[model samples]
Target: MLKEFKKHCDSTSLSAVCTQLTELSNQAFCVNNGNIPKWQSALDDVQNTQPGKLSFKPPYIAIDTKADVSGLTRSLKKLMPWRKGPYQIGALQLNSEWRGDMKWDRVKNHLRPLNGKTVLDVGCGNGYFTYLMSLAGAKIALGVEPFLLFNYQFQAIRSLIKEPIKAFVLPLKLEQLPAQPLFDTVFSMGVLYHQKDHKLHLQQLMDVMKNDAELVLETLIIDQQHGDQIIPEDRYARMRNVWRLPSTNTLQSWLEAAGFKHIKLVDVTKTTPEEQRATHWIGDNTQSIKDFLDPENNNLTIEGLPAPKRAIFICQK
Candidate 1:
């Protein structure tokens, strides 16, 4: 996968930072994570299965391949808590926690064409949407996720595809990326609220984008009724790292302040159980949206804060 990524990078504007990116990724893989052996074992088992054609079968990043269902399931289970996708691999349905397609539907139509464009997907869990971006005609869709397990999950899916797909996921964070104006389209979905400094995060994103590059920012936001923003005193919706939940208006102002132009607030939808529900594929910890919310009031979390409501903002660098 690194070889393919290096080759692809050499063919694009990413050539400037190709060596550095690959080295960082290699170093990440070499880290002493005890789970690596188990994840690698799962990846090996997946690679042994029959390779197949890949497609978008709505609600699934379907892989049309024949395989031993029981064996395949067992191998995939080793990398549990599948959060982003609901993939179909032949007879098995790997139903993930999030029905990612729902979020995709809300943002797909509002984008500029991705055809032949170099793209970046920050915090791209297992490259589900990254694959979609590649399928939507991006020349190359690079997904950078800091989580090591998700990178392994991505490889599991990639190993099943008979043909090489243009999508690739690297085990790296936004702060680790070379500050070169490379990508034409960049996505920061479900990531901003996790940052300690939201403005720094936005600025870092800007530094990596080419002139007129489009950024698709998606994160939790509160309604104006909650005030300009809410700095969570503790956990929000059971997510410990959540720092700030800005109102849509405040978010726009932040974008403007960050030097982004043509800022547009595209969509704001409150999360629902149907979009994020527990499935067997998510392993033993089956708790989900309902568990996080107040049993008496669906509008508030167990912590008495507003429920998870996300907004998508599109702007130009």
Candidate 2:
């Protein structure tokens, strides 16, 4: 993956960041994650499978391969808790916890054409959207994910494909990246609320963006009726990392304060069970948005805060 990334960087304006990126990826992938052995074993299974034709078939990011379905299922289950996809491998539908295509549908038509553009997908779980970006003709779609398991999952999928698209997921965080203006388009989806300092997060996002580059910002937001924002008293939806859920107006202001221009609030939709559900792929401890919300009142979380409503803001840096 690092070698492929270098080849990609060498071919574009991103060459300046190549060495630094390589170093960061090396350091990240080397970390001692106890689960590495199991993850690697699963990746081995993916690698052994016959090469497949990859395509975005609406709800599925499918690979048309002639492989033993039962064996493949067993192999994939080893890397369980599939969080970000609904992929089709041969005839088996690896239905993940999140129907990522639905999120793509809400944002795709609104995006600037990706053809020939250098793109970044921050917190890209297993690089699902990264593959879609590359398929959309991005010059190169670089996905940075800190979670080591997710990086391995990405490699597993990449190994199954016959042709390598210009998409690569590296085990690195946005903060670890050099503050270089490289990407033509940047996506910070489902990441901001996790930041303790939202302003710094926005600033870091701006730092890597080329002049006039577009940013597609997606994060949990409270309704304007809930006042400016909600600093979660504890947990928003049973997840501990969440920090702030800003109003759409508050989010727009933050973008303006970060020196972004032409900020546009493109979409605001509540999360639904259809998009995020408990699946066999999520493993034994299956829980989802449905479990996080109040059974008595769908509009409120179990913690009694505003339910999970996400807002998408597109702006220029």
Best by lDDT: 1
lDDT of each: 0.95, 0.91
* Top-TM-score structure, candidate number: 1
TM-score of each: 0.99, 0.98
Model 1 TM-score?
0.99
Instruction: Report the C-alpha lDDT of model 1 over 217-293, residue by residue, as the tens digit.
Output: 99999999999999999899888999999999999999999999999999999999999999998889999999999
Error of 2 at 30 (Å): 1.5
**lDDT, residue 177, candidate 1:** 93
Cα shift from native, residue 194, model 2 (Å): 0.3
Please list all clashing residue pairs in model 2, or write none if there are none.
none
lDDT of 2 by residue, 150-249 (tens): 8888898888888877999988899988888989999999999999998999999999999999999999999899999988878889999999888999
